[model samples]
Target: MAARETTNARTLTIALAQYAQLELSDPSAFDHFCQSVRSICEASARDGKKIDLLAFPEMHLFGTGTAGEDEANQAQLDAAVDIPQSNGGETEFIADSLPARCAELAKELGIWLIPGTFCERNPEGGIYNTAAVFSPSGELSGSYRKICPWRPYERYTPGDSFTVIDIPGKGRLGLTVCYDAWFPELSRQVAWLGADIIVNLVRTTTPDRRQELVLARATAITNQVFVASVNAAAPQGVGQSLLVDPEGEILHDSEGSDEELLIDTIDLDAVSRVRRIGTAGSNRLWEQFRPDDPEIPLPLYEGHIKPLRWQPQQH
Candidate 1:
């Protein structure tokens, strides 16, 4: 990844592989997805604007059209990933592992890659909707599980932690998946923890997509960080794969609901510029408030949530 020079800040070339939603009927279908990514990288190289960070959407394997795990075929879902227990490393992906394959591809293309979320088998014999970022060095740079699954009936277990990875020549890229974007706390947490850019992988459909864009932009302005909010672009998705700058200005927004890959450059140092100028972190409530300080015990959501007599559809 080459350094993209800016006025006084470092820039990064981001390529949003807004992949068409895919139903991984077999392993071959997954391979085809890899081939598509390769072709995109080849095109970039030919154009002489080689990508620094290439990000894909969330749950790209399942196609984002499934009702839930209960309705999805268990066997097919199990075959979608190879979660090697002892394979993942900061500098390497284990043999035959999903992370390994993504890392291999990233190295082949000489670009950092975020291959979106996968079903990771945990040590407890459970599965998690995990997302990983592979470096151009063929290393797994960041790994985060979806802390909040898509409402109820989501099969994967919720993750307990979030992470920010320091990409050499780029910036600290915070990682999250899917519904985590809705909760302000998650983005704020990442921002407070030294994230220059928030990379969220989403596979959203219609009706709720407008809210997704709203949250994406708001998070950027609130945190004063770049937000690479990418979503699946297919029949099952409403592909508004967006890239918002620190000022909450929409840099690249897909007008079409189809496969629209975002290839744009962003200045990572703009985040620091805003923060140092007292317009972002220095002026926020986080800077004034302390966790140890006492506050009113009033709950903004003060009531217990119990299921109603009838459940909502399209969850």
Candidate 2:
């Protein structure tokens, strides 16, 4: 008699790790950071609560400040690492070491890992803030770049690709970095590419931007995709890590103080249901509005930029 094969329906229990570690300038600091992440994942696993995905904060390994720029951009260069190309044979050499370490960790835990933006050296040797996905099989799944460059990121190169990755029965996953969450258009584009979930790993300093985070939820409803955001706790960004559902419901969140794990069970079927039904509480046609008309430029004139100079003189 031949043995029968069985198919297993896949479901994921995601854990958004909120850490409060101090950002360090020393490259040696990554060892401790890796240890912390491993300990958290392993502890959670031992509790019979296996974390399918662990989302870390943006610039979680190193600090987020720009330093030593006047001297030939050495600060950014110092943090930058050449992925898969570093001369050092140590798998833990440079920033690439973090992702490699996470991959190995994920394989050991049999879970997926999503570490937010790390400095990457491009093929041309220029630096870019990049995010990488590691599979439980210990393989690099997909990598994404921060689309919107804020502050010191103006000099960093932008990525031209929008990739949607498949995660077994979890539907398609979309990747975007820090500032990318600010643009609704980016989320729309990610949705149009058929992603069921859009994950944003961010580092923000302004806590008053709760409205902006709410706007992220609105974007999720409009795009009919679940939004999972992971951010660092204290001394880093706004520190509000959240998970917003396709219906604009806040599934989970964390305040700035606790080094917490906000876990949520995502229903992969909700993507198409909410989009197609568009019934009572799920309308999303507002997404069809276009503002690209040449005549629709802001300020209605040049007054927007130099408003103080262009102000109407005392009448």
How high is the CA lDDT of each candidate model?
A: 0.75, 0.68
Kindly state the number of residue pairs that clash in model 1: 0
Candidate 2 lDDT by residue in tens digits, 125-174 = 66777887777887777777777877663566887777667787667788
After the best TM-score superposition of candidate 2, give how far the Cα of residue 62 lies from its true spot, in angstroms: 2.4
List TM-scores for all candidates, in order: 0.83, 0.77
Report the Cα lDDT for candidate 1. Answer: 0.75
Error of 2 at 22 (Å): 5.4
98-173 per-residue lDDT for model 1 (tens digits): 6777778888888888877887766676678888877787777768889998766566779999788888666788
| Pairs that collide, model 1 | none
